[model samples]
Target: MRRDPEPLLNIKANAEAPADARPPGERDPYLTHLGERIRSLRATRGMSRKDLARGAGVSERYLANLETGTGNASVLLLRQVAGALDVPLPVVLAEVDGHADPAGQEGQGGHRAAEFSQLVQWLAQLPAGDLARVREAARHALSPSESRDARRRRIALIGLRGAGKSTLGRALAAAEDIPFIELNAAIEQEAGASLSEIHSLYGQAAYRRYEMRALERVLREHDTMVLATPGSLVSEPATFNLLLSRCYTVWVRTSPEEHMARVVAQGDMRPMEGNREAMTDLRRILQARTPLYSRADVSIDTSGQDADSSLRALRAQLPHAD
Candidate 1:
Protein backbone atom coordinates (compact mmCIF):
# COMPACT_ATOMS: atom_id res chain seq x y z
CA MET A 1 0.00 0.00 0.00
CA ARG A 2 1.14 3.52 -0.82
CA ARG A 3 1.83 5.68 2.25
CA ASP A 4 0.00 8.99 2.49
CA PRO A 5 2.17 12.19 2.64
CA GLU A 6 -0.53 14.28 4.43
CA PRO A 7 0.62 13.11 7.87
CA LEU A 8 4.19 14.23 7.22
CA LEU A 9 2.98 17.56 5.82
CA ASN A 10 0.88 18.15 8.96
CA ILE A 11 3.85 17.37 11.15
CA LYS A 12 6.01 19.86 9.20
CA ALA A 13 3.32 22.54 9.50
CA ASN A 14 3.04 22.05 13.22
CA ALA A 15 6.78 22.20 13.67
CA GLU A 16 7.02 25.45 11.69
CA ALA A 17 4.67 27.39 13.88
CA PRO A 18 6.89 29.71 15.93
CA ALA A 19 6.30 30.53 19.55
CA ASP A 20 4.92 33.89 18.46
CA ALA A 21 2.55 32.10 16.13
CA ARG A 22 0.80 30.58 19.12
CA PRO A 23 -2.62 31.92 20.06
CA PRO A 24 -2.48 35.54 21.25
CA GLY A 25 -4.10 34.62 24.55
CA GLU A 26 -1.49 31.92 25.10
CA ARG A 27 1.41 34.38 24.97
CA ASP A 28 2.45 37.05 27.44
CA PRO A 29 1.13 40.08 25.58
CA TYR A 30 3.05 42.63 27.59
CA LEU A 31 6.35 40.88 27.12
CA THR A 32 5.71 40.46 23.42
CA HIS A 33 4.97 44.15 23.04
CA LEU A 34 8.01 45.05 25.10
CA GLY A 35 10.21 42.91 22.90
CA GLU A 36 8.79 44.46 19.77
CA ARG A 37 9.32 47.93 21.15
CA ILE A 38 12.91 47.20 22.13
CA ARG A 39 13.62 45.64 18.77
CA SER A 40 12.06 48.54 16.93
CA LEU A 41 13.98 51.08 18.97
CA ARG A 42 17.22 49.25 18.39
CA ALA A 43 16.51 49.05 14.67
CA THR A 44 15.76 52.77 14.57
CA ARG A 45 19.13 53.48 16.12
CA GLY A 46 20.77 51.22 13.49
CA MET A 47 22.25 49.11 16.27
CA SER A 48 22.80 45.40 16.01
CA ARG A 49 22.43 42.88 18.80
CA LYS A 50 26.16 42.92 19.47
CA ASP A 51 26.29 46.69 19.56
CA LEU A 52 23.27 47.05 21.79
CA ALA A 53 24.45 44.33 24.13
CA ARG A 54 27.84 46.00 24.44
CA GLY A 55 26.27 49.39 25.03
CA ALA A 56 23.79 48.03 27.54
CA GLY A 57 26.52 45.99 29.23
CA VAL A 58 24.57 42.79 28.73
CA SER A 59 25.49 39.64 26.93
CA GLU A 60 24.43 39.24 23.34
CA ARG A 61 22.48 36.15 24.38
CA TYR A 62 20.52 38.22 26.86
CA LEU A 63 19.85 40.93 24.31
CA ALA A 64 18.67 38.32 21.86
CA ASN A 65 16.43 36.85 24.50
CA LEU A 66 14.93 40.24 25.25
CA GLU A 67 14.36 40.99 21.58
CA THR A 68 12.60 37.66 21.23
CA GLY A 69 10.39 38.14 24.27
CA THR A 70 12.01 35.18 25.99
CA GLY A 71 13.84 37.03 28.77
CA ASN A 72 12.54 38.68 31.91
CA ALA A 73 14.29 42.02 32.12
CA SER A 74 15.01 43.61 35.45
CA VAL A 75 14.37 47.30 36.00
CA LEU A 76 18.08 47.99 36.29
CA LEU A 77 18.76 46.29 32.97
CA LEU A 78 15.97 48.30 31.34
CA ARG A 79 17.45 51.47 32.78
CA GLN A 80 20.86 50.59 31.41
CA VAL A 81 19.36 49.91 27.98
CA ALA A 82 17.46 53.21 28.07
CA GLY A 83 20.64 55.04 28.98
CA ALA A 84 22.46 53.37 26.13
CA LEU A 85 19.67 54.37 23.79
CA ASP A 86 19.74 57.95 25.12
CA VAL A 87 16.07 57.83 25.95
CA PRO A 88 14.14 58.23 29.19
CA LEU A 89 13.93 54.93 31.04
CA PRO A 90 10.15 55.01 31.00
CA VAL A 91 10.19 54.95 27.22
CA VAL A 92 11.53 51.41 27.23
CA LEU A 93 9.01 50.16 29.76
CA ALA A 94 5.98 52.10 28.54
CA GLU A 95 3.15 50.33 26.78
CA VAL A 96 1.06 51.74 23.97
CA ASP A 97 -2.12 53.03 25.58
CA GLY A 98 -5.28 51.06 24.69
CA HIS A 99 -3.19 48.13 23.58
CA ALA A 100 -4.65 45.24 25.49
CA ASP A 101 -3.75 42.82 22.73
CA PRO A 102 -1.18 43.44 20.03
CA ALA A 103 -2.87 41.00 17.62
CA GLY A 104 -6.08 42.95 17.15
CA GLN A 105 -7.26 45.08 14.25
CA GLU A 106 -6.95 48.82 13.60
CA GLY A 107 -8.11 51.19 16.39
CA GLN A 108 -7.20 48.45 18.82
CA GLY A 109 -3.85 48.01 20.57
CA GLY A 110 -2.42 46.03 17.67
CA HIS A 111 -2.54 48.82 15.14
CA ARG A 112 -1.30 51.26 17.75
CA ALA A 113 1.99 49.43 18.07
CA ALA A 114 2.42 49.42 14.33
CA GLU A 115 1.51 53.09 14.08
CA PHE A 116 3.87 53.95 16.91
CA SER A 117 6.69 52.09 15.22
CA GLN A 118 6.03 53.94 11.99
CA LEU A 119 5.87 57.24 13.84
CA VAL A 120 9.20 56.61 15.48
CA GLN A 121 10.80 55.84 12.14
CA TRP A 122 9.35 58.99 10.64
CA LEU A 123 10.47 61.12 13.58
CA ALA A 124 14.04 59.83 13.45
CA GLN A 125 14.58 61.52 10.10
CA LEU A 126 13.51 65.01 11.19
CA PRO A 127 15.96 67.71 12.17
CA ALA A 128 16.00 69.34 15.58
CA GLY A 129 13.99 72.43 14.59
CA ASP A 130 11.44 70.44 12.66
CA LEU A 131 11.08 68.06 15.60
CA ALA A 132 10.34 70.95 17.95
CA ARG A 133 7.71 72.32 15.59
CA VAL A 134 6.17 68.88 15.25
CA ARG A 135 6.11 68.46 19.02
CA GLU A 136 4.34 71.79 19.45
CA ALA A 137 1.85 70.94 16.74
CA ALA A 138 1.13 67.57 18.30
CA ARG A 139 0.61 69.15 21.71
CA HIS A 140 -1.82 71.64 20.27
CA ALA A 141 -3.67 68.95 18.36
CA LEU A 142 -3.94 66.71 21.42
CA SER A 143 -4.53 69.28 24.16
CA PRO A 144 -7.62 71.37 24.71
CA SER A 145 -7.46 75.16 24.51
CA GLU A 146 -5.95 77.04 27.47
CA SER A 147 -9.26 78.67 28.40
CA ARG A 148 -10.73 75.75 30.36
CA ASP A 149 -12.02 76.80 33.79
CA ALA A 150 -10.60 73.70 35.42
CA ARG A 151 -7.11 74.61 34.20
CA ARG A 152 -7.40 78.21 35.21
CA ARG A 153 -7.58 77.62 38.97
CA ARG A 154 -5.25 74.65 39.11
CA ILE A 155 -1.70 75.90 39.62
CA ALA A 156 1.19 73.46 39.41
CA LEU A 157 4.71 74.18 40.65
CA ILE A 158 7.44 72.16 38.88
CA GLY A 159 11.18 72.12 39.45
CA LEU A 160 14.03 70.28 41.18
CA ARG A 161 13.55 68.93 44.68
CA GLY A 162 14.91 71.93 46.57
CA ALA A 163 13.79 74.76 44.32
CA GLY A 164 11.16 75.69 46.96
CA LYS A 165 8.16 74.29 45.11
CA SER A 166 6.78 72.87 48.34
CA THR A 167 7.58 75.79 50.64
CA LEU A 168 6.55 78.43 48.14
CA GLY A 169 3.59 76.44 46.91
CA ARG A 170 2.37 76.06 50.49
CA ALA A 171 2.62 79.79 51.15
CA LEU A 172 1.04 80.65 47.84
CA ALA A 173 -1.83 78.24 48.41
CA ALA A 174 -2.39 79.68 51.87
CA ALA A 175 -2.35 83.21 50.53
CA GLU A 176 -4.64 82.25 47.71
CA ASP A 177 -6.84 80.35 50.22
CA ILE A 178 -6.91 77.19 48.13
CA PRO A 179 -5.85 73.58 48.84
CA PHE A 180 -2.19 72.70 48.48
CA ILE A 181 -1.34 69.17 47.43
CA GLU A 182 2.07 67.60 47.20
CA LEU A 183 1.85 65.12 44.37
CA ASN A 184 4.31 62.69 45.98
CA ALA A 185 2.24 62.57 49.11
CA ALA A 186 -0.83 61.93 47.00
CA ILE A 187 0.96 59.08 45.24
CA GLU A 188 1.97 57.56 48.56
CA GLN A 189 -1.60 57.70 49.77
CA GLU A 190 -2.83 56.13 46.56
CA ALA A 191 -0.34 53.27 46.80
CA GLY A 192 -0.77 52.86 50.55
CA ALA A 193 3.00 53.05 50.83
CA SER A 194 5.69 55.68 51.02
CA LEU A 195 7.50 56.76 47.87
CA SER A 196 10.63 54.89 48.86
CA GLU A 197 8.65 51.75 49.56
CA ILE A 198 6.78 52.05 46.29
CA HIS A 199 9.99 52.41 44.35
CA SER A 200 11.71 49.62 46.22
CA LEU A 201 8.88 47.12 46.19
CA TYR A 202 7.14 47.85 42.92
CA GLY A 203 9.84 49.57 40.83
CA GLN A 204 9.72 52.74 38.76
CA ALA A 205 6.88 51.58 36.52
CA ALA A 206 4.56 50.97 39.46
CA TYR A 207 5.51 54.30 40.98
CA ARG A 208 4.66 56.04 37.72
CA ARG A 209 1.30 54.27 37.58
CA TYR A 210 0.62 55.38 41.14
CA GLU A 211 1.75 58.87 40.26
CA MET A 212 -0.66 59.05 37.35
CA ARG A 213 -3.47 57.66 39.45
CA ALA A 214 -2.81 60.17 42.20
CA LEU A 215 -2.70 63.03 39.71
CA GLU A 216 -6.00 61.91 38.23
CA ARG A 217 -7.54 61.63 41.68
CA VAL A 218 -6.37 65.09 42.64
CA LEU A 219 -7.64 66.58 39.42
CA ARG A 220 -10.97 64.89 39.89
CA GLU A 221 -11.42 65.86 43.55
CA HIS A 222 -10.20 69.41 43.49
CA ASP A 223 -11.15 71.96 40.92
CA THR A 224 -8.90 74.50 42.59
CA MET A 225 -5.62 73.60 44.25
CA VAL A 226 -1.90 74.25 44.12
CA LEU A 227 0.11 71.16 43.14
CA ALA A 228 3.78 70.58 43.72
CA THR A 229 4.95 67.78 41.45
CA PRO A 230 7.88 65.44 41.84
CA GLY A 231 11.04 66.73 40.20
CA SER A 232 11.40 63.69 37.90
CA LEU A 233 7.75 63.91 36.91
CA VAL A 234 8.77 65.86 33.83
CA SER A 235 10.81 62.90 32.63
CA GLU A 236 7.65 60.93 31.90
CA PRO A 237 6.15 62.42 28.75
CA ALA A 238 2.57 61.20 29.17
CA THR A 239 2.25 62.37 32.77
CA PHE A 240 4.10 65.60 32.09
CA ASN A 241 1.96 66.27 29.05
CA LEU A 242 -1.16 65.73 31.12
CA LEU A 243 0.17 68.10 33.75
CA LEU A 244 0.89 70.73 31.12
CA SER A 245 -2.53 70.40 29.55
CA ARG A 246 -4.54 70.26 32.79
CA CYS A 247 -2.84 72.86 34.98
CA TYR A 248 -1.20 76.24 34.78
CA THR A 249 2.42 75.08 35.09
CA VAL A 250 5.12 77.23 36.63
CA TRP A 251 8.78 76.28 36.68
CA VAL A 252 10.31 77.35 39.95
CA ARG A 253 13.97 77.50 39.10
CA THR A 254 17.12 78.46 41.06
CA SER A 255 20.88 78.39 40.79
CA PRO A 256 22.39 74.94 41.16
CA GLU A 257 24.18 76.19 44.24
CA GLU A 258 20.95 77.53 45.70
CA HIS A 259 19.14 74.25 44.93
CA MET A 260 21.83 72.32 46.77
CA ALA A 261 21.94 74.76 49.68
CA ARG A 262 18.18 74.75 50.13
CA VAL A 263 17.96 70.96 50.09
CA VAL A 264 20.68 70.78 52.74
CA ALA A 265 18.97 73.51 54.73
CA GLN A 266 15.84 71.40 54.76
CA GLY A 267 17.82 68.55 56.39
CA ASP A 268 17.99 66.37 53.27
CA MET A 269 21.49 65.13 52.40
CA ARG A 270 20.65 62.26 50.04
CA PRO A 271 21.68 64.21 47.00
CA MET A 272 25.14 64.75 48.42
CA GLU A 273 25.63 61.64 50.55
CA GLY A 274 28.52 59.52 49.22
CA ASN A 275 28.43 61.33 45.91
CA ARG A 276 31.38 63.59 45.17
CA GLU A 277 29.92 64.43 41.72
CA ALA A 278 26.64 65.61 43.21
CA MET A 279 26.92 69.20 42.02
CA THR A 280 28.19 68.13 38.61
CA ASP A 281 25.34 65.66 38.23
CA LEU A 282 22.85 68.29 39.37
CA ARG A 283 24.07 70.72 36.73
CA ARG A 284 23.87 68.04 34.06
CA ILE A 285 20.31 67.08 35.06
CA LEU A 286 19.22 70.73 35.09
CA GLN A 287 20.85 71.27 31.72
CA ALA A 288 19.17 68.24 30.16
CA ARG A 289 15.77 69.09 31.61
CA THR A 290 15.90 72.81 30.82
CA PRO A 291 13.98 72.48 27.58
CA LEU A 292 11.19 70.49 29.21
CA TYR A 293 11.07 72.79 32.24
CA SER A 294 11.08 75.89 30.03
CA ARG A 295 7.82 74.74 28.44
CA ALA A 296 6.02 75.95 31.57
CA ASP A 297 3.58 78.84 31.18
CA VAL A 298 5.62 80.84 33.67
CA SER A 299 9.08 80.66 35.26
CA ILE A 300 10.35 82.21 38.47
CA ASP A 301 14.00 82.12 39.54
CA THR A 302 14.20 81.80 43.31
CA SER A 303 17.95 82.22 43.50
CA GLY A 304 19.14 85.01 45.82
CA GLN A 305 15.55 85.74 46.82
CA ASP A 306 13.91 85.25 50.18
CA ALA A 307 10.86 83.01 50.46
CA ASP A 308 8.46 85.96 50.71
CA SER A 309 10.02 87.64 47.70
CA SER A 310 9.89 84.47 45.66
CA LEU A 311 6.29 83.93 46.64
CA ARG A 312 5.44 87.48 45.64
CA ALA A 313 7.18 87.07 42.31
CA LEU A 314 5.27 83.86 41.64
CA ARG A 315 1.99 85.52 42.48
CA ALA A 316 2.71 88.38 40.17
CA GLN A 317 3.37 85.94 37.32
CA LEU A 318 0.25 83.85 37.94
CA PRO A 319 -2.99 84.22 36.03
CA HIS A 320 -5.37 85.39 38.71
CA ALA A 321 -8.62 83.51 39.16
CA ASP A 322 -11.75 84.83 37.52
Candidate 2:
Protein backbone atom coordinates (compact mmCIF):
# COMPACT_ATOMS: atom_id res chain seq x y z
CA MET A 1 0.00 0.00 0.00
CA ARG A 2 1.14 3.51 -0.82
CA ARG A 3 0.04 6.73 0.79
CA ASP A 4 -0.30 9.96 -1.13
CA PRO A 5 1.76 12.99 -0.10
CA GLU A 6 0.44 15.07 2.81
CA PRO A 7 0.06 18.60 1.61
CA LEU A 8 0.05 21.26 4.35
CA LEU A 9 -1.99 23.56 2.16
CA ASN A 10 -3.92 25.03 5.03
CA ILE A 11 -0.86 26.22 7.01
CA LYS A 12 0.14 29.67 5.88
CA ALA A 13 3.01 31.90 7.00
CA ASN A 14 0.82 35.00 6.73
CA ALA A 15 -2.57 36.14 5.58
CA GLU A 16 -1.13 37.29 2.26
CA ALA A 17 0.11 33.82 1.32
CA PRO A 18 -2.30 31.70 -0.70
CA ALA A 19 -4.12 28.88 1.10
CA ASP A 20 -2.95 26.42 -1.58
CA ALA A 21 0.64 27.56 -1.37
CA ARG A 22 2.03 24.30 0.06
CA PRO A 23 4.00 22.43 -2.57
CA PRO A 24 2.75 18.90 -3.16
CA GLY A 25 5.06 15.92 -2.79
CA GLU A 26 5.64 12.72 -0.85
CA ARG A 27 8.86 13.77 0.85
CA ASP A 28 11.13 11.72 3.12
CA PRO A 29 9.14 10.21 5.97
CA TYR A 30 11.70 11.28 8.56
CA LEU A 31 11.65 14.85 7.36
CA THR A 32 7.88 14.86 7.10
CA HIS A 33 7.51 13.47 10.60
CA LEU A 34 9.99 15.98 12.01
CA GLY A 35 8.18 18.79 10.20
CA GLU A 36 4.85 17.63 11.53
CA ARG A 37 6.24 17.45 15.06
CA ILE A 38 7.62 20.98 14.75
CA ARG A 39 4.32 22.24 13.39
CA SER A 40 2.32 20.51 16.11
CA LEU A 41 4.54 21.92 18.87
CA ARG A 42 4.22 25.39 17.39
CA ALA A 43 0.45 25.07 17.31
CA THR A 44 0.42 23.91 20.92
CA ARG A 45 2.41 26.98 21.93
CA GLY A 46 -0.04 29.22 20.05
CA MET A 47 2.75 30.50 17.83
CA SER A 48 2.73 31.12 14.12
CA ARG A 49 5.50 29.93 11.81
CA LYS A 50 6.69 33.53 11.63
CA ASP A 51 7.11 33.63 15.38
CA LEU A 52 9.10 30.40 15.41
CA ALA A 53 11.18 31.59 12.49
CA ARG A 54 11.99 34.87 14.21
CA GLY A 55 12.88 33.23 17.53
CA ALA A 56 15.02 30.65 15.71
CA GLY A 57 16.68 33.48 13.75
CA VAL A 58 15.75 31.84 10.45
CA SER A 59 13.82 33.26 7.54
CA GLU A 60 10.08 32.73 7.14
CA ARG A 61 10.65 31.01 3.81
CA TYR A 62 13.18 28.67 5.38
CA LEU A 63 10.76 27.89 8.19
CA ALA A 64 8.03 27.20 5.66
CA ASN A 65 10.43 25.00 3.75
CA LEU A 66 11.33 23.14 6.94
CA GLU A 67 7.70 22.64 8.00
CA THR A 68 6.95 21.25 4.52
CA GLY A 69 9.79 18.63 4.77
CA THR A 70 11.71 19.88 1.73
CA GLY A 71 14.56 21.33 3.76
CA ASN A 72 17.65 19.29 4.65
CA ALA A 73 18.69 21.13 7.81
CA SER A 74 22.18 21.02 9.29
CA VAL A 75 22.87 20.23 12.92
CA LEU A 76 23.21 23.95 13.70
CA LEU A 77 19.90 24.78 12.09
CA LEU A 78 18.25 21.91 13.94
CA ARG A 79 19.62 23.31 17.20
CA GLN A 80 18.14 26.73 16.43
CA VAL A 81 14.77 25.12 15.80
CA ALA A 82 14.99 23.19 19.06
CA GLY A 83 15.86 26.38 20.94
CA ALA A 84 13.00 28.32 19.41
CA LEU A 85 10.60 25.45 20.04
CA ASP A 86 11.97 25.16 23.61
CA VAL A 87 12.55 21.42 23.29
CA PRO A 88 15.55 19.15 23.50
CA LEU A 89 17.14 18.63 20.10
CA PRO A 90 16.59 14.90 20.40
CA VAL A 91 12.81 15.41 20.23
CA VAL A 92 13.10 16.97 16.79
CA LEU A 93 15.54 14.27 15.69
CA ALA A 94 13.81 11.26 17.26
CA GLU A 95 12.65 9.32 14.17
CA VAL A 96 15.74 10.03 12.08
CA ASP A 97 18.04 9.48 15.07
CA GLY A 98 16.64 6.02 15.62
CA HIS A 99 16.80 4.83 12.02
CA ALA A 100 20.09 6.63 11.42
CA ASP A 101 21.49 5.55 14.75
CA PRO A 102 25.25 6.06 14.71
CA ALA A 103 25.83 3.22 17.20
CA GLY A 104 23.86 0.62 15.24
CA GLN A 105 21.82 0.05 18.39
CA GLU A 106 18.48 0.34 16.60
CA GLY A 107 19.18 -2.61 14.25
CA GLN A 108 18.68 -0.66 11.04
CA GLY A 109 20.84 1.33 8.54
CA GLY A 110 24.10 0.48 10.30
CA HIS A 111 26.48 -0.29 7.46
CA ARG A 112 28.15 3.08 7.83
CA ALA A 113 28.53 2.57 11.55
CA ALA A 114 30.25 -0.79 11.16
CA GLU A 115 32.47 0.59 8.39
CA PHE A 116 33.41 3.58 10.53
CA SER A 117 34.31 1.30 13.42
CA GLN A 118 36.49 -0.77 11.12
CA LEU A 119 38.18 2.37 9.85
CA VAL A 120 38.92 3.45 13.43
CA GLN A 121 40.37 0.01 14.26
CA TRP A 122 42.50 0.01 11.13
CA LEU A 123 43.80 3.45 12.01
CA ALA A 124 44.74 2.23 15.48
CA GLN A 125 47.23 -0.18 13.83
CA LEU A 126 48.89 2.63 11.86
CA PRO A 127 52.07 4.61 12.80
CA ALA A 128 52.06 7.22 15.59
CA GLY A 129 52.32 10.15 13.14
CA ASP A 130 49.44 8.84 11.02
CA LEU A 131 47.35 8.22 14.13
CA ALA A 132 48.02 11.78 15.27
CA ARG A 133 46.78 13.18 11.94
CA VAL A 134 43.74 10.93 12.04
CA ARG A 135 43.05 11.94 15.66
CA GLU A 136 43.14 15.62 14.67
CA ALA A 137 40.74 14.95 11.85
CA ALA A 138 38.44 13.06 14.20
CA ARG A 139 38.62 15.95 16.64
CA HIS A 140 37.55 18.27 13.84
CA ALA A 141 34.67 15.96 12.99
CA LEU A 142 33.64 15.60 16.63
CA SER A 143 34.00 19.28 17.51
CA PRO A 144 32.78 18.67 21.03
CA SER A 145 34.31 19.88 24.30
CA GLU A 146 33.85 18.36 27.72
CA SER A 147 34.91 21.54 29.52
CA ARG A 148 32.48 23.74 27.60
CA ASP A 149 29.77 21.23 28.44
CA ALA A 150 30.81 21.10 32.07
CA ARG A 151 28.51 22.72 34.64
CA ARG A 152 29.84 26.12 35.69
CA ARG A 153 30.47 27.74 39.07
CA ARG A 154 27.27 29.78 39.05
CA ILE A 155 24.21 28.80 41.12
CA ALA A 156 20.76 29.45 39.66
CA LEU A 157 17.44 29.54 41.55
CA ILE A 158 14.45 28.52 39.47
CA GLY A 159 10.70 28.29 40.19
CA LEU A 160 7.45 30.24 39.98
CA ARG A 161 7.46 34.06 40.06
CA GLY A 162 6.76 34.42 43.77
CA ALA A 163 8.65 31.33 44.90
CA GLY A 164 11.29 33.47 46.66
CA LYS A 165 14.02 32.88 44.07
CA SER A 166 15.04 36.52 44.17
CA THR A 167 15.23 36.74 47.94
CA LEU A 168 16.96 33.42 48.42
CA GLY A 169 19.32 33.93 45.49
CA ARG A 170 20.44 37.30 46.87
CA ALA A 171 20.97 35.92 50.36
CA LEU A 172 22.96 33.00 48.99
CA ALA A 173 25.13 35.36 47.01
CA ALA A 174 25.68 37.62 50.00
CA ALA A 175 26.62 34.69 52.22
CA GLU A 176 29.14 33.46 49.68
CA ASP A 177 30.32 36.97 48.76
CA ILE A 178 29.40 36.38 45.10
CA PRO A 179 27.40 38.66 42.80
CA PHE A 180 23.66 38.26 42.42
CA ILE A 181 21.62 38.52 39.23
CA GLU A 182 17.93 38.53 38.49
CA LEU A 183 17.60 37.33 34.89
CA ASN A 184 14.39 39.20 34.12
CA ALA A 185 15.86 42.39 35.58
CA ALA A 186 18.87 41.93 33.32
CA ILE A 187 16.51 41.53 30.38
CA GLU A 188 14.61 44.61 31.39
CA GLN A 189 17.84 46.59 31.62
CA GLU A 190 18.92 45.44 28.19
CA ALA A 191 15.57 46.37 26.64
CA GLY A 192 15.57 49.74 28.39
CA ALA A 193 11.94 49.13 29.41
CA SER A 194 9.72 46.94 31.56
CA LEU A 195 9.08 43.34 30.58
CA SER A 196 5.54 44.24 29.67
CA GLU A 197 6.78 47.09 27.51
CA ILE A 198 9.26 44.83 25.80
CA HIS A 199 6.57 42.24 25.19
CA SER A 200 4.23 44.90 23.93
CA LEU A 201 6.76 46.27 21.46
CA TYR A 202 8.44 43.03 20.38
CA GLY A 203 6.42 39.96 21.36
CA GLN A 204 7.59 36.93 23.34
CA ALA A 205 9.95 35.82 20.58
CA ALA A 206 11.91 39.06 20.83
CA TYR A 207 11.86 39.03 24.62
CA ARG A 208 13.46 35.58 24.56
CA ARG A 209 16.19 36.92 22.31
CA TYR A 210 16.88 39.67 24.80
CA GLU A 211 16.87 37.16 27.62
CA MET A 212 19.39 34.93 25.86
CA ARG A 213 21.72 37.80 25.10
CA ALA A 214 21.55 39.17 28.63
CA LEU A 215 22.30 35.79 30.13
CA GLU A 216 25.17 35.33 27.74
CA ARG A 217 26.64 38.64 28.80
CA VAL A 218 26.26 37.77 32.45
CA LEU A 219 28.00 34.43 32.04
CA ARG A 220 30.80 35.99 30.04
CA GLU A 221 31.45 38.79 32.49
CA HIS A 222 30.92 37.10 35.84
CA ASP A 223 33.09 34.26 37.03
CA THR A 224 30.66 33.33 39.82
CA MET A 225 27.18 34.57 40.75
CA VAL A 226 23.78 33.64 42.09
CA LEU A 227 21.14 33.88 39.36
CA ALA A 228 17.41 34.05 39.89
CA THR A 229 15.58 33.06 36.74
CA PRO A 230 12.05 33.67 35.49
CA GLY A 231 9.52 30.96 36.30
CA SER A 232 8.56 30.43 32.68
CA LEU A 233 12.19 30.03 31.57
CA VAL A 234 11.72 26.27 31.77
CA SER A 235 9.39 26.59 28.81
CA GLU A 236 12.46 27.60 26.78
CA PRO A 237 14.31 24.31 26.84
CA ALA A 238 17.42 25.51 25.04
CA THR A 239 17.97 28.42 27.37
CA PHE A 240 17.19 26.23 30.34
CA ASN A 241 19.56 23.53 29.07
CA LEU A 242 22.26 26.13 28.72
CA LEU A 243 21.57 27.19 32.30
CA LEU A 244 21.76 23.59 33.47
CA SER A 245 24.97 23.10 31.51
CA ARG A 246 26.60 26.09 33.14
CA CYS A 247 25.03 26.43 36.56
CA TYR A 248 23.92 24.47 39.60
CA THR A 249 20.20 25.20 39.36
CA VAL A 250 18.04 25.04 42.46
CA TRP A 251 14.24 24.92 42.56
CA VAL A 252 12.92 27.39 45.12
CA ARG A 253 9.83 25.50 46.28
CA THR A 254 6.90 27.18 48.03
CA SER A 255 3.19 26.67 48.51
CA PRO A 256 0.51 28.31 46.34
CA GLU A 257 -0.82 30.24 49.32
CA GLU A 258 2.62 31.57 50.15
CA HIS A 259 3.27 32.40 46.52
CA MET A 260 0.11 34.51 46.23
CA ALA A 261 0.61 36.04 49.65
CA ARG A 262 4.19 37.03 48.90
CA VAL A 263 3.31 38.60 45.58
CA VAL A 264 0.50 40.54 47.24
CA ALA A 265 2.59 41.45 50.25
CA GLN A 266 5.28 42.79 47.94
CA GLY A 267 2.54 45.20 46.74
CA ASP A 268 2.39 43.72 43.27
CA MET A 269 -1.37 43.24 43.38
CA ARG A 270 -1.45 42.81 39.61
CA PRO A 271 -1.80 39.05 40.03
CA MET A 272 -5.29 39.24 41.60
CA GLU A 273 -6.45 42.80 41.14
CA GLY A 274 -8.31 42.60 37.87
CA ASN A 275 -8.02 39.02 36.76
CA ARG A 276 -10.55 36.70 38.40
CA GLU A 277 -8.67 33.60 37.23
CA ALA A 278 -5.25 34.70 38.43
CA MET A 279 -5.00 32.25 41.29
CA THR A 280 -6.22 29.38 39.10
CA ASP A 281 -3.78 30.32 36.35
CA LEU A 282 -0.95 30.54 38.85
CA ARG A 283 -1.84 27.10 40.17
CA ARG A 284 -1.94 25.68 36.68
CA ILE A 285 1.41 27.27 35.81
CA LEU A 286 3.06 25.99 38.96
CA GLN A 287 1.67 22.51 38.39
CA ALA A 288 2.87 22.51 34.81
CA ARG A 289 6.37 23.76 35.72
CA THR A 290 6.86 21.38 38.64
CA PRO A 291 8.32 18.59 36.48
CA LEU A 292 10.68 21.00 34.80
CA TYR A 293 11.61 22.61 38.11
CA SER A 294 12.43 19.17 39.49
CA ARG A 295 15.29 18.95 37.02
CA ALA A 296 17.27 21.41 39.18
CA ASP A 297 20.40 20.14 40.88
CA VAL A 298 19.03 21.14 44.27
CA SER A 299 15.77 22.29 45.88
CA ILE A 300 14.94 24.39 48.94
CA ASP A 301 11.39 24.59 50.22
CA THR A 302 10.93 28.25 51.10
CA SER A 303 7.42 27.65 52.38
CA GLY A 304 6.98 27.97 56.18
CA GLN A 305 10.61 29.02 56.37
CA ASP A 306 11.99 32.47 57.04
CA ALA A 307 14.74 34.18 54.98
CA ASP A 308 17.71 33.12 57.14
CA SER A 309 16.52 29.54 57.51
CA SER A 310 15.82 29.10 53.81
CA LEU A 311 19.16 30.61 52.89
CA ARG A 312 20.91 28.35 55.37
CA ALA A 313 19.18 25.29 53.91
CA LEU A 314 20.08 26.30 50.35
CA ARG A 315 23.68 27.00 51.33
CA ALA A 316 23.94 23.59 52.98
CA GLN A 317 23.33 21.96 49.60
CA LEU A 318 26.06 24.01 47.91
CA PRO A 319 29.57 22.61 48.12
CA HIS A 320 31.99 24.62 50.35
CA ALA A 321 29.12 26.95 51.36
CA ASP A 322 29.10 25.83 54.98
Q: How high is each candidate's TM-score?
A: 0.66, 0.56
- Residue-level lDDT tens digits of model 1 in 1-322: 9765653234443344333344644545556677777866553332345555765779989887777776553433444556678755554555776455454545666567666656776786799999999998898778656556778799999998789999999999999999999999999999999976885577667888999899989988988999999887887777888899889999999999998888789887543455577686567667757788899999999999999999999999998556
Q: Which lDDT tens digits does candidate 2 get at residues 10-86? A: 22322233222345564655567777767655543434565568767899998888788776534334455566776
Q: What is the lDDT of residue 318 in candidate 1?
A: 90
Q: Which stretches of candidate 1 lie over 4 Å from their true place?
A: 1-110, 144-146
State the C-alpha lDDT per candidate. Answer: 0.77, 0.71
Evaluated at residue 124, the lDDT of candidate 1 is 69
lDDT of 1: 0.77
For candidate 2, the per-residue lDDT at 314 reads 90
Q: What is the C-alpha RMSD of each candidate to the true structure, in Å?
A: 11.7, 13.5
The most accurate candidate by lDDT is: 1
Best by TM-score: 1
